[model samples]
Target: MKRFLGFIEKEFYHIFRDKRSLFILFGMPIAQILLFGFAITNEINNVEIAILDHSKDATTGEIINKISASKYFSINQFIEQEADIEAAFKKGKIKAVLNFENDFSKNLVKEKQATIQVITDATDPNTANTISNYINSILQNYQLDQNKDIKIVYQIVPQTRMIYNPELKSVFMFVPGVMTIILMLVSAMMTSISITREKELGTMEILLVSPLKPFQVIIGKVVPYIFLSMINAVVIILLSIFIFKMPVQGSLFLLGLESVLFIITSLTLGILISTISATQQTAMMISLMGLMLPVILLSGFIFPISSMPAPLQIISHFIPAKWFIIILKGIMLKGVGISLLWKETLILLAMTLFFIGLSIKKYKIRLE
Candidate 1:
């Protein structure tokens, strides 16, 4: 019994002393909990939307007021022409639009019925569908209010017209996730290994001493992998489009730009890992433990962030993939341009700068 206890203590000593082992055992669980909390959720709130009130009547005004008062939606803009609804959705400014037909009050008075068109950008079908349901619920309550004196049912059926993806394909939800995972695996894992291999061979030190600055050398090392990861990204997109028939509603140029930015982010993160690790095995383990799990499980790729716990929901904001997946869905599914997605774009840019800065700092520390 004494010998067995001593053996266990010795093993624990080995684990605690190794930084990588300590990180894997302790740091990983904290990271997982935080990621899951922030990234997964089953609720919706504060959805952006537009209104096109052709009726412009007293009743219509009241209905619009009711919708605007609800916590589920924030009216981003008002459109005059029916043609501009498509334009607003393409710009990604609003998730849904409430279109009150021209003779809304007249029809409601004479026929006890009127049409309200709820147009939605269905890139992320879940969000679009939820917004429609919320609007419908509000309208149903309004119907009950106005018809208190009448014995007839005043039905205000909301016609939820799904734009971009009429069929609400499940594949559309995953294209961004799958592409993110693939690009992450390829760019991050390989870049870490390649850089660590150079470090092991003493080539990284030689390059550091060359005419090129450390940043230039690191960029030179990662440039080739960026091309390779881009190729992987293109292949994934092509397969998603051809096999799944997932529509690219947004600009392809913008999609390409976002993909490239993600690839660079992954590469920079991998470089940071390489700086901390001494061998290829160490780099690989760090990349897998640090980047891959958080991205795959906690990035809102498979799970809805609204369903997650409050603490985890708050923590998920720090994951880079969470923002990138959003950007992907907005472009590929919603057909939204950069104008509507600037916030997510800036988040990704900030993450990239952070990783590069941290990696450089570590590299300088090693030299001393």
Candidate 2:
């Protein structure tokens, strides 16, 4: 019993001494729980929406005020005309637009009913559905409030139109998200171990003594994975198109170019991970734990980013997957060209350069 107790104490000491173990045991759980608790939510708050008041009457004004008063949505803009709605959605700021039919108050008084068209950008179908429902609920409550003392009960009918994805196909949303995850993880996981494996197997010294330069070594390590990841991306895109009947409304050439850029970004990030890590296991852990959760949760793939707390929303901007997902959705669903997508494209390019530069610096440090 004394010997067993001594062994147990030794194990505890070992665990406490290793920072990685301590982090895994205590830090990771706390972080994961906090992230999950905050990130994984269905309810949206401060979702940006637009209003196109055709009637511009007291009734429309009251309804708009009620929607704006709710905690669920914020009125981002008041659109001028019907033609601008498509342009607004393509800009990717507004999620839903409330279009009050002409003569709304007069119709409510004379015909005892009025129609408000709820047009939503359904690239993310779940969010679009939720927005439509919330607006409908607000209209219903307003109707009830106005009908309290009247013999003729007034009705406000909400007609919801889901653009881009009229059927609200969940797959339309998931394909882009899954594709982003696959490209991010596979590319990162593959090259993350490249340098660590060399270090572990005593081959790093051989490379160190070779005629090849540091950049040459780094490029050599990453170039193969670039081709492999590209193939993986092509396969995923083809499968999505043929099997799922997913449409690529934008230019295929542009899509290919963007995919290549993201793949390079992910691969360079993997190289950076490889340079910093001491062991293959460590590299793998960092790549999986550090990359996967953020990609899934904060990328606005599963949940709306605008719905999250202000801090998480700010942190999400740092997530490359979030930008890549935006690019994919823009190209696939909205069919917007590079003119509209230039900002996101530039952000990915900048990230790629940043990762490459950092990897080179880290590699030089290892050489010294």
Candidate 3:
């Protein structure tokens, strides 16, 4: 027991001794959490837009006032001619241009509807779509206000609602995926690199020849990473809760347990990778190319897996992060219990077992 504890201490020393590794382990999680939480978000804010009001009427002025007053947009400039619209967009600061048709108030009084041309820069499709939606919403609100004093013959009001994320904050969508990625980076990438570094430094053979068994050696190497990764997990959760005001509606205990399961799964994957790779560079490449890409692209982190092509959807099932992401969003967003997440939990467990078995088999063969 003393010897095993000493080996664990030695591994800790190896980790803390390397400045680059320390930074990657600690600094990356904070930087990534801050970046994803604060900077990378889908919510639009104070978009600069140019307006062209051909009518120059009271109603058009009111609509413009409402639009400019709303937090979503700031009127950059009101242009005189239509030709200037293209130049404004070409300059690249403005996201949208709102053009009211001539005699907008007269048309509304005569036909009960007025035309408004919303020209948006399609450079960023999402941003453009959001800008258009905001404009439409503001117009709809103004129209409702106009009709509030008058009686309507037949009104069919469609009440659209959003559950879970009512405000649709992108942070809610990204937190789970970011947590998964951080765990993957620490568990799989770090462990694989640590093990490979040992082999490269000629220290792994010394341990292999020591009184300690191979299983003990592997466990010793991975245990420190598991603790460090969990610390990272805690930090991420705390940041989401306090800074972002993100609620963990489900069982915090379940979240932690599932996190541990994923951590173990990631650690086993690193072990499997290390067994196959003889050099640190090879392990790092495999972790980034093979693991990172699949986790980021295929895991339904940024893109919905269901929306993917049939072939890619089929391939995504093999990616562990997909299941983990579902588990995360379920627990964090929906507040779901284990009863709801049994399948994903079981899948992660099975993957963990498979990787551990394969790694052990390969390591034994290498020993022979």
The model with the greatest TM-score is 2
Clashing pairs in 2: none
lDDT digits (tens) for residues 1-368 of candidate 2: 99999999999998888786666668767877878999999998999999999999988998999999999999999999999999999999999999999999999999998999999999999999898888898899999999999999888889999999998889899999999999998889889888789988989879878999756776798888888888888998999899988889999999999999999999989989888777798789888888999999999999999999999999999999999999999999999999999999999999999998898898888778
Kindly provide the TM-score of model 1 when superposed on the true structure, using C-alpha atoms: 0.81
Question: On residues 31-66, what C-alpha lDDT tens digit does candidate 3 reach at each position?
Answer: 446434443345566788888889999988888899
Query: What is residue 208's positional error in candidate 1, in angstroms?
Result: 5.8
Off-target runs (Cα >4 Å) in candidate 2 are: 1-21
lDDT of 1 by residue, 187-246 (tens): 988998998999899988899899999888888889999999999999989999899988
Among all candidates shown, the one with the greatest lDDT: 2
Candidate 1 Cα deviation (angstroms), residue 194: 3.6
Query: Residue 211 of model 3: what lDDT?
Result: 100
Model 1 scores a C-alpha lDDT of: 0.83
| Model 3 CA deviation exceeding 4 Å by range | 1-157
Error of 1 at 244 (Å): 1.7
